[model samples]
Target: MNRKTLALSAVIGLLAPVLAGCGGSDGGSGGEAIVVGTTDQYIATDEAIAPLDPAAAYDTGSWNVLRQTIQTLMHVPRGGGKPIPDAASKCAFTDRANESYRCTLREGLKFAGGDPITADDVKYSFERVLKINDPSGVAGLLTNIDTMESDGAREIVFHLKTPDATFPYKLSTPPAGIVSKKDYEPTKLRKGFDVSGSGPYTFKAEVKGDTVTKATFTKNADYTGELNVQNNKVELQPFTDADEMGKALDSGDIDVMTRAMTPEQVESMVEKPKEGIQLTEMPGLEIRYLGFDTDAPTVKEKAVRQAMAYTIDRGDLVTKVYGSVAEPLYSLIPSSIATHTNSFFNKYGDRNLTKAADLLQTAGIATPVKLSLNYTTDHYGEATAKEFETLKDQLNSSKLFEVSIKGTEWKSFRPNQIKGDYSVYGMGWFPDFPDPDSYIAPFLDKDNFLNTPYNNAKLRGELIPQSRREADRSAATNTFSQIQDIVADDVPVLPLWQGKQYVASRDDIAGVEWAVNSSAELLLWELRRGPGAS
Candidate 1:
């Protein structure tokens, strides 16, 4: 939502049909190969699309398939909750203690360029990420990887510094995908326009800086592994903008939509289904937030932060701005994952201007304590901006604070944030993994996820490392509860509503059930011009 390439949401430009309908397209009905339409274009790649380089991929929609079309030694299968294979067909804990793990590659598995997907390739891909050392450390979703060693042609071993129970889940991500050392020479920077990978589908047309497209994939008969789907072709058309995607979906441009749809778009699809259109709703990994620049003079006061939290009406924002599509978020950790808390609801259910004013007074915040809120205007569009305005009006009308709202494109939001340029800001997070650790890790720890440079003595010194020390993370619930308490009390980043996950598809587009990371993947292998398709 940080980039706005489409104006349909704001301008109300009906470039395509506006209606909602649904049914099923039988694979029984055949025509030319199905041509799905997309309203949004794939976000252009600065180079070729390659999951080989961690620095090269992270955006959700565009990255998911590229992450898939590329292979990893092990993958996290939906519902299985365990690691399966792509490069490594068979794997085991040779040590029996689950301390050291090894895997054997499937013979004949080769890159699109025909290079054997060797253990050395697997080692190179990982060591290279450590070498690049991406500052954001977002790549660390699979980090602390200690060392990856190759045992000749078919096998690879992983030695961890500690017993990581979530190791399999880590391998399930795109950042952990395997790559060819021959193709990804760690010594030189990669030009991704034409990269090598071994997945079900291979790249066809790549418009660098805009899109990388895969046409049809003939079955990789060699890939007789644990996965679903039989079709040989699929299209991964992605865009940085959500509205444009809505338009593209509305227009007959792409057959499937990989992101959450706006309420208006959802309404349209609800009205139609047989004309190659449909919608799928599920819980998502992404969570939007209201962050406070902890470095700011105003945000440092606990009462001010609490006042801000109490005064804003999330229900109104959901009804008016989100069209009640997204669920109201009362806690930072969403229920879709696990062990989420309804702390905010427990604290403040209805908006109370009087309570906020009293808290402000206790914190010495006199009337009209002028503050500015910043967000990415075009990213989430008019709806997001409207919500911010509603929040601003709520805070200002209390007579204890004055508020202003502003924005920038996501392309520039990062740098400004790093500089600590705003007092209050709007932010969002799509989990890097499916755990509570993912929810807590990125925000704090002095490294600065928000650039606010927050340091909570309790969190950094206590809860974090305690959770990391335990392999059975669910057992660390008591620690996370304390962490949540500190987070709520400190209020560096306040929890906002969680956006619902949605994917609008032409019934023919199959194989996308809820992904662990909450992505909608349309691999050609899982689809054919089937029932309820356009």
Candidate 2:
């Protein structure tokens, strides 16, 4: 098992108290039933749920609910690890080249509504997601699929356009969660929040008082999967801001809180321990960086890019702006993962103002290179303003560069960025999956997720494809290491920092520590009241 997998296994082991029925008994005589409180900022937005139908649900809030309420062929084990069989009895690549894959469904599988789950449903699920092809949906991840066919009553086969070792991992995500053909429309998305899924929980979403502030889930007794639900019910509360969520947590209105906490709030919680509150600091795979528009006149020069990379002090940015909630990232791949390489640090070393100035001078560039730095205020956090200001101060201090910082809300910023409206801009990524490919492939590929055009033929055409062919993920480390080195030299983007995952919960919650799943989604099934609770 990898470091992430091991960490998840450890978390699962810590749930012994919850699994042993310590808090499952009646409140009067034995103990109180566990109640989990979670916050979703995405749902709090105006366009609530983008689309609740699995075919169109791509946002984080919708995914969080879908992952629990729906069943996929494979799933990440509790406490964050490798993908194992869930709906399928066993799944593996049929071909030696890793192109063809197959999955055999487990016997006697049924949805929460008691509808039988069969290979036909599995085939329909993948086809429906592809046919709809919602731009916001994650169907792009399934582009490698050439065809999906049901082999028999229990077996399903996938024919891929390319050899993608990560395909199985993708199936464990919400995009691949199987939906009944009988319940869903084949061409269009099913409207409303009602769902018929076969996962551990039965989910019901509603917009209370004309706004989607809350979604509740009940444990499905008919669930035929690996996970054992510890709580009878889980409630997801959407807050407009972190302050509201923090207040709710403090007042015991919520048993647990995850995501949307500002860096300062996290630091405060860490500095002063709250009475009966516990925090779990897990390794995060999220990365924030500055992407450069290659076509932009200001940053078109390679030397200018290298100069910016060498001049900025990442160490200072982490300490002063982030309050040490994040660590300076040397590579696009986060340091927590095995494939990460300190390529930038190796090439540029610590902050060297003179070296940066000399590089620009040698390239015949004039002094005080003017560049506009664009960032999104609403998306990243209020601290993002401070982060960019610190960057401006750091670069301006060198006297070799003049910086102009601008901010916009995420909704406006994304489209403008994609249209190549910004010279140098800030962007953060949350991985779709845990694999190293999630970091490198999305950024470096020809049709990258970034608004800026960054196509490295070597990294995109060869290294990534080669790495995907390797069945053992560790063996692909060499390919990723080389890709990082190329990124350092090219300087298409300057990695700022990689964050650490933190979850705050009441100390009475024993299983709260293991709430996060392998995909980094918080699993309410793992949370239950600990010993000596009210």
Candidate 3:
């Protein structure tokens, strides 16, 4: 099946409406402005959004905003799947071993503030992200880079420590977004809401009560990129609650709702068909999993981790907690990606109590092992409580374990998880870039974002490094296969389920289906208020 076919199959029989380009009651060819609603208040809440400076903005909300305002050397094209030149006229590996990369800037390139974009700007942008080196920042993605050199005003070259074919893909992310040295401080982070960028949109933000309540994005006439703005003006609004956002969508307060809408919300909208609202489902690379801190007394034993993985019923978790909105995942890499392998499923076919028991016996573990599982309530969704409860019930049913469940908000949860306060915890990953390496490297690296005590030399030293050198993604499948087998054996983390992306908008919105871009950032430029839209 083709990509579109595969994406449609995950929508649970709502494929026809999405594929037919169905619009809401108030439908038109699209010319009016739009208000996009999101339950993702990370930017508004100030709890997750770090410094908005391109170098320090690592969270999803900050990146979503930056991706629109700042132009990167290359970007995942709108609706198209591959990375393509955005700020650069062209970009490619210059060396035979893929250690060097070069890009030539588009002529007459200028920032929104009218500063000339040059090779110097490109070099400064990358070096600054590395220089700031915020612990939470995404500079780690550029660790392979040895140095950057400017050929002239228009061309820049990158030298690498080792052969890395995925370097260009890393540059396409927000951390590599080119910034004007004339506007931003080279060493210190740029503060305040004022942003200087060169992309499809010029952002003007409004901060109210420590949250970005509204962001007004105007078209950048100076932008020299692939994005063609359909709507002249777009306003992004944040809601503290999904129900509030849902009401706004139904009341025509917002033209579209993009992120953090729970499965229950989507199902409610689909079943009742809210008068003017329609749902568009896209293929998502979001994977939810359980991480085991190998240093934790309860899970230090590999058998305990394997038993937890073998005992939980993924089918029931998806059906009961996720309501079929998500599919059970068996690999760290989402199945949609080319390098994915169902190693976990192959190793442990189903929830076999006998097998879990045998594994525990082999490791000399006593029965009724005490386990503490931690999760965040506000971060994931309201359903997360039920999800953990269901998981606790499953493990307790095995009669070999006693589980304690703890819940906290994301603000406290993140720092505590990083401090290794949780014995076992749940994590949901939205990829930094669409690659198998993004899944493997960040999660297993010695100083992983999760801060779990997980270490596999073969995976960290050999398989991942070997896979990074393969220019052809398909040829690296063997390396990814080995990585997955190792992940299954180590049992540091258990793959749970992968979610399907859902965007709900009023029927009059014409481009709702295309709102989610290849990098999984919601493109507000794609949305337009249709002819009869409220």
lDDT for each candidate structure = 0.61, 0.75, 0.78
Ranked by lDDT, the better of candidates 2 and 3 is: 3
Best by lDDT: 3
Q: Worst lDDT window (10 residues) for model 3? A: 1-10
User: For residues 1-534, what per-residue lDDT tens digits would candidate 2 score against the true structure?
Assistant: 013422222233333211111223222111343444444443223333345677766545567788888888887775456778988989999999899999999988998878888899988888888898764536767767998889778999999988988888888878798888777889877765667689888877667543456677888888887787887877777666678778887777776677757887787876776666666666566789999998788999889999999999999999998876788999987776677889999999768988998999999999899999999876656678899999999999999999989998665676677678898999877777777888776677754556346677787679988988877777787888899999999999889898766777766675655676433576778777657442
Specify the highest-TM-score model's number: 3
- Model 2 stretches astray by more than 4 angstroms: 1-39, 43-61, 182-196, 208-211, 362-367, 415-421, 517-519, 530-534
RMSD in angstroms, all models?
7.2, 4.5, 3.7
On TM-score, the stronger of 1 and 3 is: 3
Worst 10 residues of 2 by lDDT: 17-26
Model 3 stretches with alpha carbons more than 4 Å out: 1-32, 43-51, 191-194, 531-534
User: lDDT ranking from best to worst?
Assistant: 3, 2, 1
lDDT of 3: 0.78
